[model samples]
Target: MSELLSIAQLSVSFGPVKAVRAIDLQIRRGEAVGIIGESGSGKSVTWLGALALLPGATISGSVMLNGQQILGASAKSLPGIRGKRIAMIVQDAQSALNPVLTVGRQVIEALQLHRGMDLWAAQAEARRLFDLVRIPSAGRRLASYPHELSGGQNQRVMIAMALAGRPDLLIADEPTTALDVTVQAQILDLLRDVQRETEMALVLISHDLGVIAEVCSRAYVMYAGRIVETGPVDQLFAAPRHPYTRSLLEALASLDGPLRRPNSILDGTAGAMVQQQGCAFASRCPNRAGVCSHLEPELSAGPDGWRVACLRADVAGPLEIVA
Candidate 1:
């Protein structure tokens, strides 16, 4: 598969606080990539920065899409790429959708903008898209408002709007965040199905490792504002080298696993970006050492593309060396 998007040395800052720092990632054609971490992990901010969507944010980076440099591009050029080439769906569908408009009208508007379709053609395509996302009574539902539908249905409508653009890439930022367990599963399955059927590259952002594992073959784990680990999901889950990654696994509650009491030793969540030069996770890491507090680890891989950035791990790169 060809590389669809490439982001390098990406960083976002709001005033004195840094939200995302030096993020490097790539997405290929027709593949699913997942970003998982805590709420403050900068998972969503990275993409928002990449797309130049963050207001009052200072973004310094290179974002390439199919060989074109998109980061910091002129505002006039972004519209051509945002929806027509790449679409996004947020977590809260109700708020994202305009309350006054009918569900179908919102999607139809996107169709008209991105697809250049007339009212009749856009409406027809909108209904088809609603059916594609598996909404029931696709035709009649066009008149319904966002509040009139269930959460799942509203999410499906949002999905339809995204698909109406027929984008080559779709960024889903916590698309299932506001749903119950069953609905979350359903929405994930729907996203998977849509990706497979359309052959569009998918980037799913969420805090749930299990959810990422279910939908993506490759995943990136973030902490603070940096990507701590990136590799095949199965490999990371089976053998999580980073202390933070392991802690995330330990945090998950499952019926199949034994019940345990809460354990939170970290002083704060992963969202804060400080001026400290050392590793951001060292403060919370159980394996913290003298070296961790002074030297930040560089993310490197050994040709296999499994990258990790931890002074405690044997991840310095092409040549293996014990810390």
Candidate 2:
């Protein structure tokens, strides 16, 4: 699997506040990679910088896609890559879709723009896309507005529009967040089947661990503005090295676990404060040591391509170190 996208030391800033700091990620062709973190962890910000969607935003570092430099490209050239080669499905379908436009018209517009199909041909392609997304009454639904459809149907329309461009990479931001459980499973299965057929790389961004585990081959856990842990989805979920990662899994596990308190809230304020010397997670970490307050730990490779940014990755069992 050749590398399709490589992001190294990427940083994004808004005014004096730094949202993402030196994040590194790599995605191979046809691979499914996930970025999981709590809200405001900078997972979405990093990808936004990569896509060049943030206006008045300053970005530094390298973003190489298929060996082509993308960090400093012109805005005019960005659309050529945005919808045509690298598509994104935002979290809110209602906000992303035009309310006035019919579902089929929206899909047809995109197809005509990128795939270069005429009006009649584009409509045919649109109908096929509707079927591909498993939407019933494909012909009748084409004339219906976005508001006329259910949440799941709107999401399917978003997926169909994204696929219209035939992108090499698809960035899905919380793709199933707004759907019901049954609908979520169906959407995930749809994505799985589509990926199998198209062989396109996927970048799934979400705060849901279960969602990541279900679809992604690999996962990266973000804290504050940096990657704190990364590994194969199953292995990382089984034995996470970072305390933050462990806490996330504990929060998601069955209610029988001792860590499954309904009101357990991991303190995240410390992550917002910059630590020039110590680990960023030290204040909230359950395994913090004296050295953790004064020394930052670099990400070190562990077994099976796993990387953890903790001073004591060798430790096992529940942590006692805390603020």
Candidate 3:
């Protein structure tokens, strides 16, 4: 699988606050990757900054898509690449879609804009996309406005609109955040099926470990705007190396065991933005040593291609927490 997207030393800052630190990531063709972290961890901001979607953000570093640099592309050049090459579905479907416009019109607009389909062809394709996303009464529902549709239905419509472009890469940012548990499962299943059928690369950004483990083969764990660990989802979940990763795993509720007390890491919130000379997670890390408070750890590759950015990774033990 050739690399479809590559981000190196990418950073995003708003004035004095750096929302996304220098982070590197890569995605290959037909890959399903997950970016997991708590809110403000820069999971969404990294991609948004890469796509030039963050207005007034000071973005630095390189974002390459199919060998083309997208970070500093011209306004005219970006539109051609945005929806056509890479499509993003945001968390809030209601706000993402125009309430007044019928779902069909919105989807048709995307098809006509990116796919270059005629009005008649666009309508046909829109219905097909709706059906693809498993929207009930696809044709009739297309005429209904976003406000008339249920939360899950609106999400499906959003997915359909994203698919209308036939994009090579799809970025789903907490796509199931507002949906109920049952609907969340449905959306995840739909996304997985669509990716498999289309062979399009997917980047699932969410805080839910179960959701990430269910769909993504590879996963990256971020902390305070930096990637702290990354590996195959199964391996990472089973034996997380970074202290933060282990803490996150421990926080997940398990069915087989008695409920365990949440770790202190969950209680501590991310600190305010300041120049950090050490590990960003040192403040909350249970395994933090004096070295961790002064020296930032560099991400180093370990066994089985697992990468971890922890000074104490060598001493880290297997996570006892089971999901």
Q: Model 3, range 1-323, lDDT digits (tens) per residue?
A: 89999999999999988888889999999999999998999999998999999999999999999898998999989878898899999999999899888989999999999978899999999999999999999999989998899999999999998888889999999999979999999999999999999999999999999999999999999988899999999999988899888888878777776543455345577845557788888888878899998898999988776999999998888665423
Which one wins by lDDT: 1 or 3? 3
- The C-alpha local distance difference test score for the whole of candidate 2 amounts to 0.87
Whole-model Cα lDDT per candidate? 0.87, 0.87, 0.91
After aligning candidate 3 to the native by TM-score, how far in Å is the CA of 132 from where it should be?
0.5
**Candidate 1 lDDT tens digits, 217-278:** 99999988999999999888877778788777766665754532256335555535867778
Q: What's the CA error at residue 221 for candidate 1, in Å?
A: 0.7
Estimate the TM-score for candidate 2: 0.93
Taking all chains together, the TM-score of candidate 3 against the true structure is: 0.97
Q: Which candidate leads the pack in lDDT?
A: 3
lDDT of 2 by residue, 42-151 (tens): 98899889888899988999999899998889877877788988999999998889998898999999999899999999999999999999999999999999999999
Model 2 spans with C-alpha error above 4 angstroms: 255-264, 268-270, 273-276, 318-323
